[model samples]
Target: MSDVRESEGLTLLGNQGTSYPTDYDPGVLETFQNNHLDRDYMVTFRCPEFTTLCPITGQPDFATLYINYIPHIRMVESKSLKLYLFSFRNHGDFHEDVTNVIVNDLAKLMEPKYLEVRGLFYPRGGISIYPFANWAHPDFGYAELARTRMFEQLSDLDRGDGTR
Candidate 1:
């Protein structure tokens, strides 16, 4: 679901985020479907077909991820972030590693009250794996933040896909 085919340095296309993996396998999809919706503030962006080349195999690794977080004051600039994330295209890492790397990078940038990232990797070798990770800031309003997975009722979506 890339909005711009070419990268624009620090700038990014205001294109909606898309999922990177879908063909992984059926099991992965089923895991995502059955997973709980525990989250505080939720923002879902559908990167319908996100791709990142494997550093080892030189093949693309894919996933549909849901990022949920409660912000404090600082916030991520969407376009810039889109570019930052897309920079991973030629980068290779395991699903868990990539998902965690993103969450950590974002936490450092935005330092939100709470954050969670769920990577629904496509099924590989009959295994559909979804890696989920999150972070919580102890600095401010950390306790009163909404911490629930009730996903269906989430009010907004970057589209309907899960990112940011």
Candidate 2:
């Protein structure tokens, strides 16, 4: 979750059918230029169905990724984001790790005033886990937490998204 989702250099990354982030950027750039998210007030991208393989088990994990943030100077190009998210196709890691990684990467590149990522992974065995990650400055308080609660409420919704 980036406080400021709008940015100039915020474009997509990676290639498709592979773990490359390049292929996903160009298209997203067109959207950025066309839609002008770089100047928008708030933005939310809900990647409902995402998948990736487990590093050791070679098993697949399913989760839905919700990226919410506000734009500052630049906005993330949609294509690059698609590619970047696609880059995890063959990646191996736990729900928590991946969630944190995406947050950190975006934080470094975009430096949004607020950023949050909610990873709602499907059930494995008899239980399901929802991995949540967020970043906020000491100045801004309470809002992010409440938002997290709202996102976490997904457990109450049957028509939710998942990724692997």
Candidate 3:
């Protein structure tokens, strides 16, 4: 993969002795040119090991983050993304804030045609909080798609089995 010209921006892909960050740093994120610019397709990442500190209680909060995006010209590198997410380990923020911040940072990094981030936090104080945020380019017809997907996610969480 290193021989490919498109992989030039990747710095952490196959490197040994990787170091995880101890605080929130958006600079850890990296991206490469999108190879499939002619097609509009979704790329999804499931980060099940996401963790951070709660702002109010300073307690550790755990979540599975679902990131979906439609690339424009650049795509995020996965190893860099792992390190970037790890940077939030010691950072403190509310559930909603964390979700929004991630989406905002990723949007700025890739400038995707459409993007959405959903954080499914573990239960705390007998309640679980799931925050979802999405963005779409005004010229694209994706704004309606974003709204529809949001409703679908909400419906999925309301299965009445209390499993969300």
Candidate 4:
């Protein structure tokens, strides 16, 4: 188990006076050392209130952002993750772009063995958009898993199942 010292760099976790960012800022993210590097496990985060603006219309877009990953040596702090997601409230981007950006940011942040981000944006014009992005480290033997999941999501979409 990790001692309290392992979490010393986490500022937003317990801080009562955190100033939420007003723009898209990946800098707000913070991580602590993963205690179980010896074993591989999945970590999932669901942000049901994720909000962002449409770049063209400047209208609000609501989504439930799902982030799943297999950690390597570090794990993101949940409070910091919440604040980071909240930072997107005023940022403008397309659904696909936002999902890809999240996956990229988190992939760089943790360099995890495997990572994936899915954004299920509510329909704005009778057309719902769910974007999915994923990556895997070459050394972790997760490339096939990523490919399989990607294809599975695509299949589900084709079946109108909305499994993602």
Candidate 5:
């Protein structure tokens, strides 16, 4: 992959001794040209080890982050994304805010045709918080897709089965 132009923007992928950031830093994200721009497909990332601090109590909040996006011209580099996500480890924010921030940052970075961020936070005070956010390029017809996915998420929550 070294000779591939798409791999040019990657920096943290194979590096050793990575230092997780102590603050929220969206600049840690990196992107590469999407090789399959002619095709429309979904890329999903399931991160089960996500953690951030609660805004009020400063206690650690654990969650599994589910990210889905349809690439346009660029796609995020995985290792750089991992670093960017980890940068929130010590950052303080509500679960809903964290989900929105992630989706917004990725949208700014890649300008994907569509993107969604869902955070499934662990139960606290006998209740669990699930935050879901999504965006789509206005020029494309992806707004409908985003809406559909949002509806599906809400429907899933209504089921109260908690399987997903």
Candidate 6:
């Protein structure tokens, strides 16, 4: 039911011949204009099968990646996002670094009002690592919100609570 104009700049959505990348490729992320400029709403993506390699060991690392954002004028297309994340399967990086990299890439692509990436990595060698990163547009009055939310998330650990 969507018009062609509504799907401009989107190439990976319905293409049946799309190929998956074997490396980290942020260039594959595509976006389209946001229709709701008059309101602020949350957009969230949960990728439960995210996989990458450890930078040092080259062993596989698995994670559930959470991406949350408030769009400004453009929004990432879902199929492209899936491909972009899939591109990390063979990439090597620490969980922290990988989480930050994804956030940075999406932030640059959309320039959203606010964006955050959270990676809940499965235990490797008896240790689980959770990496979180976020950004807020300086002039958009969301900087404080970013700080506060980050604090709240981190503070749960300080209180001996495992919830995040």
Question: lDDT by residue for model 1 over 129-157, one digit each (tens)?
Answer: 56666777876555433354334224333
lDDT of each: 0.56, 0.63, 0.88, 0.88, 0.88, 0.88
Tell me the spans in candidate 4 whose CA falls farther than 4 Å from its real position. 1-7, 155-164
Candidate 2, residues 41-91, lDDT tens digits: the string is 556888867776677896988878888766554456666676677767777
**What is every candidate's alpha-carbon RMSD to the true fold?**
11.8, 7.2, 2.3, 2.4, 2.0, 2.4
Please estimate how well model 1 matches the true structure, expressed as its whole-model Cα lDDT.
Answer: 0.56
Taking the tens digit of each residue's C-alpha lDDT, what string does model 3 give over 32-74? 8888888999999999999999997899999999899999998
Q: In candidate 5, which residue pairs clash?
A: none
Please estimate how well model 4 matches the true structure, expressed as its whole-model Cα lDDT: 0.88
The backbone clash count of each candidate, in order, is 23, 54, 0, 0, 0, 0
Which 10-residue window of candidate 1 scores lowest in summed lDDT?
A: 25-34
- My TM-score estimates for the predictions, one after another, are 0.60, 0.65, 0.92, 0.91, 0.92, 0.91
Measured with C-alpha atoms, the lDDT of residue 109 in candidate 1 is 68
Q: Report residue 44 deviation for candidate 2 (angstroms).
A: 0.4
Error of 3 at 75 (Å): 0.3
Candidate 4 weakest ten by summed lDDT = 1-10
lDDT of 3: 0.88
Cand. 1 TM to true fold: 0.60
